[model samples]
Target chain A: DAGITQSPRHKVTETGTPVTLRCHQTENHRYMYWYRQDPGHGLRLIHYSYGVKDTDKGEVSDGYSVSRSKTEDFLLTLESATSSQTSVYFCAIRPQVYSGNTIYFGEGSWLTVV
Target chain B: DQQVKQNSPSLSVQEGRISILNCDYTNSMFDYFLWYKKYPAEGPTFLISISSIKDKNEDGRFTVFLNKSAKHLSLHIVPSQPGDSAVYFCAASSPGAGSYQLTFGKGTKLSVIP
Candidate 1:
């Protein structure tokens, strides 16, 4: 898993609730990303951080916000969870070296919203 | 509007036969491409990668071929094994985009029958 951990590996929540998923890495890599995987959608980047406190929106960034207050942690928060947001979330880290820009992925956090 | 696309939803191949997965992209600036394999309940894992500057990259039984002019790429696994059955995703990234964030396809599920 490339020394990456995603907290709350499985969670069931209600619609209109708030949820936050945490990603921690021991690699101390400068780049970290949050992605969601759903049927028919392999993986869509929700947000990414290039450095501490530097985050940017991705293709499916709507309703999702991310924060990186420290070098080892990147957090993704769903301000208001929706039924459509129920999916498997993955955290990834990229090594500084450009070994074909390879990125490593965590196990994944499955969230179900009712 | 997906920048990357994997047309096949699923593929079935005989054990010890050849397996080929295809992907296409619409972005002209994409300079890097990669293939990832995912099993049930696990995040996608990096399998192989290729740069736009090169046409082919080989690693063990996996070979990735890139055609920059057609904006397409494929992964060929010769003598495929049943253990290779999984969902395969094709991802792309542009170096000039400043961030190494990747765009991924819908993925193709591969089933290797014994």
Candidate 2:
């Protein structure tokens, strides 16, 4: 286990509401990522952090934002949730020790926007 | 445009048979490939990975084959068991800064039928 934990495993909210998902890791990895999984689109990167307070946009990052204030916590926020933004969000971490480009994922957060 | 593609949405294999999941990529810069297995309501777990320099990597009953020339990869599961049923995702990444971010293909759902 990578010791990754994601909060708000399931949620339903009205459109235009704000939602924040939290990902906490026990292993102090330097890299953390947020991704959304949709039926036909698979998993798309939303944002990633290489270190505390350092972040960058991924392939699909228009409506989402992320923050990594500490080594173990990464937060993803939907400024204004929309129906199209409904998806299963996943948090992943890459261990610095491993030479291979493999990242471990946490249990996903399921969000439904109506 | 999708950088990676998994054309097959679903596949079924009899128990003890071999299950092959194929993936193709459009980006030649992707040098590292990975496969992830995800069960319903859970996060995707890392399965196996291969570097661009190698054509194949194996772990027990699971093997991943890469064809750099064709920009394709396949995951082979030998003696498939019912427990192997899950969504398999193919992901790739290039080398350099931000290389930890992976581009994923739409997943292929695998069902190992008894």
Clash count (model 1, backbone only): 0
TM-score for each candidate, following the candidate numbering: 0.97, 0.97
**Model 2: runs farther than 4 Å from truth?**
B97-99
Instruction: Judge candidate 1 at residue B60 and give its lDDT.
Output: 98
User: What are the lDDT figures for the candidates, one per model?
Assistant: 0.94, 0.93
Displacement of residue B19 (Cα, Å) in model 2 is 0.7
Q: What DockQ does each listed candidate score?
A: 0.85, 0.85
Could you give candidate 2's per-residue lDDT for residues B1-114 as a string of tens digits?
998999999999999999999999999899999999999988899999999999999999999999999999999999899999999999998986384778899999999999
Model 1, residue pairs in steric clash: none
Steric clashes per prediction? 0, 0
- Native contacts recovered, in order, as a fraction for each? 0.78, 0.84
